[model samples]
Target: MAAPAAAISAPGVLADLLPASTRARAVARDAVLVLGGAAAVGASAQVAITVPQISPVPFVLTTFTVLLLGAAYGPLRAGLTLALYLVAGMAGVPWFTEGASGFGFPSFGYIIGFLVAGVAVGWLAGRGGDRTVLKTAGLMVLGNVIMYAFGTPYLAYATGVGAAQAVEWGITPYLIGDAIKLVFAALLLPGAWWAVNKFRSQD
Candidate 1:
C-alpha cells in the first residue's frame, strides 16, 4: 500500500522519518538522538582555526553543525541536544572549541546562542521552513543573526571591549564564512527533502 497522505505531505523534520513503533521505543530513540546530536556538535567544535588578529572568536564549524542538526532534529530534540552540549561543556567536558571548557571564554555566548538558534530553526523546520531553498536560506540567516545577537554582547563583556569593537571582533570576520555555510545549508536541506520525497514516491 502507498504511504498515508499525511506522511507524504508532512514528514516533519528528517529525524521524523525514523520509525518508533512503541512509546518506550520512541523515548529511547529520542534519547539516542539527543546524545548523538550533542556529541556531533562537540566533535564539530574541534574543527576550528583561530585568527586572533581578526577576532577572538575562532572560526569553527560548530554553528553550521548546530543549525543543520536543529533543522533535522526538530525543536524539542534539537533543544535537548544543544542543552546537553552546553551543560557538558560548561561542566568541563573539554569538548568545546580547541578542546576548551568552562564558561568565561569569549566565545561561550555563541555556544549559548547555539541552543536558542537550534530550537528556533527546529521550530521553523517543523513548520516546513526547510522544505525549499529560499526558505532554508532565510532560516539559516535568522539562525546566524540570533547567534550574533547573543554572542556579540557577551563577547564585549568578556573581552572588556565596546559594542562596536565587539562587532568588529566577534561578527565582522565571520560574515564571509557564515554566508558560505548559509548557502551550503540552503541547497543541502532542500535537496535532502527532494531526495527523500523521490525515494518515498518510488517506494
Candidate 2:
C-alpha cells in the first residue's frame, strides 16, 4: 500500500518537482527550483561578507535546502537539483551573494560537498530513516560532513591559512545556524509521516 501510494501519487504534484527529461522538464525544473532556491537563500539569512584577506566566498544558507531537497525529493532529483543550483550560481545568478559570479575559488569544493552530503541524505531516506524525522536528522548530519571536507581546502588555499583556520573561515561561523537547520530537517520527516498517519488512521 505504501509503495503503491508512492508510485500512484508520484506524478503531477510531488514527483513533478523535477523532470526526468533533458528538455521538457527544464522549464518545470527551473520553476520548481525557484522555491528551493528561495528556501536555500532563506536558510542562510545573513550573507557573511567575504573579507578578501580571509576568503573570497560569502556565506549563505543553502545547506538547509540541500538537506530538504535530499529528503523530500530523494537522491536523483535532489542531487541533480542541487547540482543545477550550483550551476546557476556559476553562470552568474547572484544566487551566491558574491555580488559577482562564475565558478571560482572556495565555492568549488563546497559545491562538491553539497553533492557528497546530499547523496548520503537521499540514500539514508531509503536506508537510514524511512521518512521519519529522527533518521532524516541523522542522515543530514552525515551529509553535512561532506560539506566540511569540500570547504576546508578552499578556506586554506585562498585565505593563505591552515586546516583549522579554513574550518574557522567558513564552517565555524555557520555552525549554530546549521544545527538549527539540522533539527528542522530532522523533524520534517517525522512530521510528514505524522500527517500521513493521520490520514491513514481516518480509514
Candidate 3:
C-alpha cells in the first residue's frame, strides 16, 4: 500500500517545483506570452526607418520586444522564444523588417542580436528587476549593447566591410533607436508586471 502511494506521489512532488499559482497559470501564460511575442515581432517588423542612403539597414522596434520579452519571461524561456521568432522569420514567416522573408542573409547577425538581447534582459529580470522601470531601461541598454556585439560581426562578414566600418554603419546608426526602445521597454515591462502582480496581490 505504501509503495503504491509513493508511486502516486512522485508526479506531485515533481510538480511542486514551480509553486501552485505559478504552475497553474503556465498554460494561459505561455499561450499569451509566446503568441504575444510573435505578434510583437510582426508589429515591430513594420516600425522601420528607411534611408536610401543605407538600404540594407533600417531602424526597427524588434529590439524593443527583444528586451521586454526577456525581462518578462526569464533567460531560458526568453532565449527559446526568441529562437522561435528567428526560426519563423527564417522560415519565411515575414517577421523581419518590411515583412521580409527567408534567411541566410547578411543581416542575420541582427537577428542573432535579438537573441542575445533577450538573454541579457532575461538575466536581469531573473535578478528581480521585473518591477523596476529604471533598472529595466538600464538593463535594456546593456542588452542593446550586446545586440551590437553579435550583429556587428555578421554585418561585417555579409557586407564585406572591415569590422570597424561595419560597427560604424550597422551598429552606430541604430544606437538612438535602441535607446528609445530602452525607454519604451522599461515602461512597458514594469507596467505589465505591476498590473499582473497587483491583480494577484488582490486575490
- Superposed Cα deviation of residue 99, candidate 3 (Å): 1.9
Over 4 Å off, model 3: 1-25, 191-203
TM-score each candidate: 0.96, 0.70, 0.77
Q: Can you write out model 3's per-residue Cα lDDT over 1-203, one digit (the tens) per residue? A: 23433343221111122333665587666656677776787688788776757536777777776777677677766777788888888888887888886765666788888887887778767776656778777888788788888877887888898977887778777777777777777787678667655654454
For lDDT, candidate 2 versus 3, the one ahead is 3
Error of 1 at 20 (Å): 1.0
- The digit string of per-residue lDDT tens for model 1 on 30-74 reads 999999999999999999999878888999999999999999999
The lDDT per prediction is: 0.95, 0.63, 0.71
| Candidate 2 local lDDT, 1-203, one digit each (tens) | 35544444422222343445677667567557655654464345245456656445555666776766666655666666667666766787665544444656655667667766765676667453636666666777777788877877865775677777777777776677778888887786668667765674554
The TM-score that candidate 2 achieves is 0.70
**Rank by TM-score (best first):** 1, 3, 2
lDDT for model 1, on a 0 to 1 scale?
0.95
Q: Judge candidate 1 at residue 26 and give its lDDT.
A: 91
Candidate 2, lDDT over the whole model: 0.63
Cα displacement (Å) at residue 30, model 2:
10
